[model samples]
Target: MHGSSSRIVGGDLASVMTREGDKVSLICQTDGKPDPTLTWTKENRNLSNPKQGRKHTHLLTLVREEDAGEYRCRAENPHGSANKTFRLVVQSTPNHMGTMVPLLVGLFLLKVFFCFLLILATFWFSNRQKKAPVMREDTTRG
Candidate 1:
């Protein structure tokens, strides 16, 4: 679905679609008497046009997790300027690290078991020393 007369004199327009965890492709279409200046913008920030001299369609690919947001395409000609907005949703796949939580917990428990064994050994040695017999010589009856 396209919106109403977002058209201008120079004929610069941009459209794009994006999905999460996938690449985003921006297509810019220009049709003017001479040629129009084509540019891209996201959240009002200006974007450099990769296709400088070409009057045909241009495609820009962005592959990044952080590149998920609203993107605006501005086509400017001598007559006027038109803009179209696109919402990009970048979905992140389930990470393998998330699946390792249980494994990590098991390893931690193993470590705790080893520590407990060390503590038990120390306590056993201390108790054994305390139980040893102590001898004193009898000086008067010898």
Candidate 2:
């Protein structure tokens, strides 16, 4: 009969944080007495991987906010199943925001300046179009 046992290879608790749009890999390993079959899952759903072994690495490229979750690696045999959980956190990259703020401010100022010039131009044109008081010259005995 086949039996199994599980032990985390690297650390007791596994966790990683990476910026969005970046690639990350989470490595999970288990030492099994009988060398149980291993599978990886996230949010209780099995994850499809082309490679399977004692040490499995989940590769995520161009990570997004939705990719953040808890991943579970299960090692199972006829005797029983053992599992370990790891956390993956995806964070927004601050570099984009840091550069965006200044660009937005510059655009806003340009808009304001253009609008002020438009109003000034409109006022000048309206006053110019108005006819000045007609000048009258009267030559007569007073």
Candidate 3:
């Protein structure tokens, strides 16, 4: 009698997204008459010992930008072998507050500059009005 052929039962082969310095896990569940041997690789390079025993969970801790790439998980037994592929995308966290602070300060300074210009213009108009000479009527009728 022949044992059941090894087959991939459950796992996620979809592209995954994560941030730098974060942790992630990829699971690869398999079913067979005899327990299948699991293996993992990144960018076609072997990961050595990436699997967590029979749980088939590959843990990535303190993930970095360099870690973003194609990952593959394979399971093999005497009968046959099966595999799955995954894509990891790493993004850097943006500092919104830091960027907004400078923008806000620039806007405030622009407002102050416009207000100063308005005050100068009002003062100049008032001085010009005061400096105007009053018309005087002729002393004797022609």
Candidate 4:
């Protein structure tokens, strides 16, 4: 979805997800003068930037089922603010394997949860490393 400073003007943000919980993507396009900061929010909470850039396009990857919700994109500049909304629906395959299938699904879900947590942790640690030196240099200068 797109938004503008004076008037929220743009197209719908496009997204795709697999029913088997394999992959996900979110794309937003916006057009405005002086450009606008594009951001995504779910349930009123601002999401972390998936990438660093000053462009009007934002992309998010590998979305999970829990990420499904009313997604709003807000574009804001010194002039004004604008926004757009989208509903994300994550589908899952039906379980036809009976009782044992439920247990297997539970375990699989747990595995995916831990894997996501691990990825998040790794990203956090990597970001810390990249910023620590800059922070130290600034402190030393002061």
The prediction achieving the highest lDDT against the true structure is 3
Compose the digit string of candidate 3's lDDT tens values, residues 1-142. 6677667776547688999999999877888767788899998889866432344877999988999999888888778888888799999778799999999999999999999999999999999999999899998998
TM-score against native, each model: 0.54, 0.64, 0.62, 0.50
Cα RMSD to the true fold for all candidates: 8.2, 5.4, 6.2, 30.0
Clashing pairs in 4: 1-12, 1-13
Candidate 3: regions farther than 4 A off: 50-54, 95-142
State the lDDT of candidate 2 residue by residue for 57-91, as single tens digits: 77889999999999877766555666677888888
Clashing residue pairs for model 2 = none
List the global CA lDDT of all models: 0.60, 0.77, 0.83, 0.64
Q: Tens-digit lDDT track for model 4 on 14-112?
A: 444455555555555555655766777877888756322234333445556676777777766666766677777777666577778889999999999
CA deviation > 4 Å runs, candidate 1: 1-21, 49-62, 107-142
Candidate 1 residue lDDT tens string, 46-100:
6665333223332445446677667766655556556556666665667888889
| Distance from true location, Cα of 53 in model 2, Å | 3.3
Off by over 4 Å in 4: 1-20, 49-63, 99-142
Say which prediction, candidate 1 or candidate 2, comes out ahead on TM-score. Answer: 2
Cα lDDT for residue 111, candidate 3 = 100
* Full-model lDDT, candidate 3: 0.83
